[model samples]
Each structure stands twice: as structure tokens, then as C-alpha cells.
Target: MDGKKALYYAAIAIAVLIGVGIVISVISALVTLVSTVISAAISLAVLAGIVYVAYKAGSWLLGSDDSPSMDSIGSGSSTSVDAGTSRQDRLRQQYVEGQISEAEFERRIGEELETEEIDDIDRELERER
Candidate 1:
């Protein structure tokens, strides 16, 4: 029992030491980063602006405007994966493109009709189209 308790205490002490080490390392890195940014010719704030522009441009080129960003966090957004396209439309497309057999398309459409989530407006639009 004493041996087990000693092992447990030693393990806890090691964990605490590791946590302290991590905290110290993070503080040292932050201090270094701030100092380097302050000592540079251009301001750190300007560097942050360049980084933000590069990030937005990269996202635009990749055609993913909905990537996680502070701008979108509080905004109302689309609830579905494909906002304008329905599952039935996609399944029909697959069949027409020869990606799926007609039987597979039928199976998928049935499954989508039974198991898919569609808002009333989307369902009405799909029917109209």
C-alpha cells in the first residue's frame, strides 16, 4: 500500500512539474515573440494584417468562404451542406453522369425521401424545379 501511494504521489509530482514547464515555455516564447515584433522595422500589427489578407485570399482561391473565422461566428448561416441542391437532384445527376446505376439512383432517392432532412421551402422548390 505504501509503495502504491509513493508511486501515485511521484506520478502526480511529475505531472505538476510538466505542467509548470509548459507554462514557463509558453511565457518565454510569448516574451520572445513580443520583443522580436517590437524590435522589427515594421509593426507586428501590420504583420497581422498581412497574415489576415493572405488567409482570406487563400480561402477565396480554395472556394471555401465558410471556413471558421471570427467574422462568421455570430452570423446566421446555412443549415444544410448543399444550400440550393436537393438529394434527389444530386442522385439524378449521378445517374445521368453514369456514376450510379438506375437501380442505385432509385434506392438513393427512396432513402433520401425517407431519411433526409429537408425544409419545407426546399422541398417545394425541388418539386417546382
Candidate 2:
């Protein structure tokens, strides 16, 4: 009877140890997963920052002047020209400077007129809405 009791006690101890070991393993796996997720998020944020900086640097270095900056918005500046007028002015300038032929200027003007008509239609739709 004493030997049987001792054997039963040993079996309970082994089961308890196995349960503790499984709990520890699960905790470690959860910790490792959380750490990996944090690392990946940090890596992605750094990559995005680098890409944005590179894009700004490239734009600055290449002298891209067509896009309006925040400073130019609502400043009531006389230099600000609408897209249709700007295109027409640029085409006329090129033609006067002999950079483009009369045929090319006329073709571009026709395209600009078509675009302006579409824009007018869009504005009318918005007004109706």
C-alpha cells in the first residue's frame, strides 16, 4: 500500500511539471510573436520615412515647379494663373519664340479648348448638385 501511494504521488508530480512546462512554452512563444510584430512595424515606418525624404530631395533637386506649394495657396498673388490660361499662354509663348511651329500651337490650343469644355461641364454638374 505504501509503494502504491508513492507511485501515485510521483505520477501527479510528473503531470504537474509537464503542465508548467507547456505554460512556460506558450508564454515564450507569445512574447516572441509580439516582439516580431513590433520590429516589423518599426522597420516599415523607417522605410516609409526614407522613401518620403528621398522623394522630396529628388523633387527639390530636379526643379519641379509646375506643382503649387502650400505657400502659394490663397495668397492673392497676381502670378497665379488658372490651368487653361496657363496652357494657352505657354503655347503662345512657345510659338512666338519659334520653339514650336504654328501647326503644333493650333493643335495644342484645340486640345486645351476641349479640356476646358469638359471642366466647364464638371463645374455645371457640381453647381446643380
Q: Residues 13-113, candidate 1, lDDT per residue (tens digit)? A: 99999999999999999999998877784676788899999998998888787665565456433434343245667778889999999888888877776
Computed on alpha carbons, the lDDT of every model, listed in order, comes to 0.76, 0.86
Question: Per-residue lDDT for 5-112 in model 2, tens only?
Answer: 999999999999999999999999999999999999999999999998898888877978456766667753323337578889999999999999999999999999
Model 1 spans > 4 angstroms off: 41-129
lDDT of 2: 0.86
Error (Å) of candidate 1 at residue 25 is: 0.5
- Output the number of the lDDT-best candidate: 2
Scored by lDDT, model 1 comes in at 0.76
- Most accurate candidate by TM-score: 2
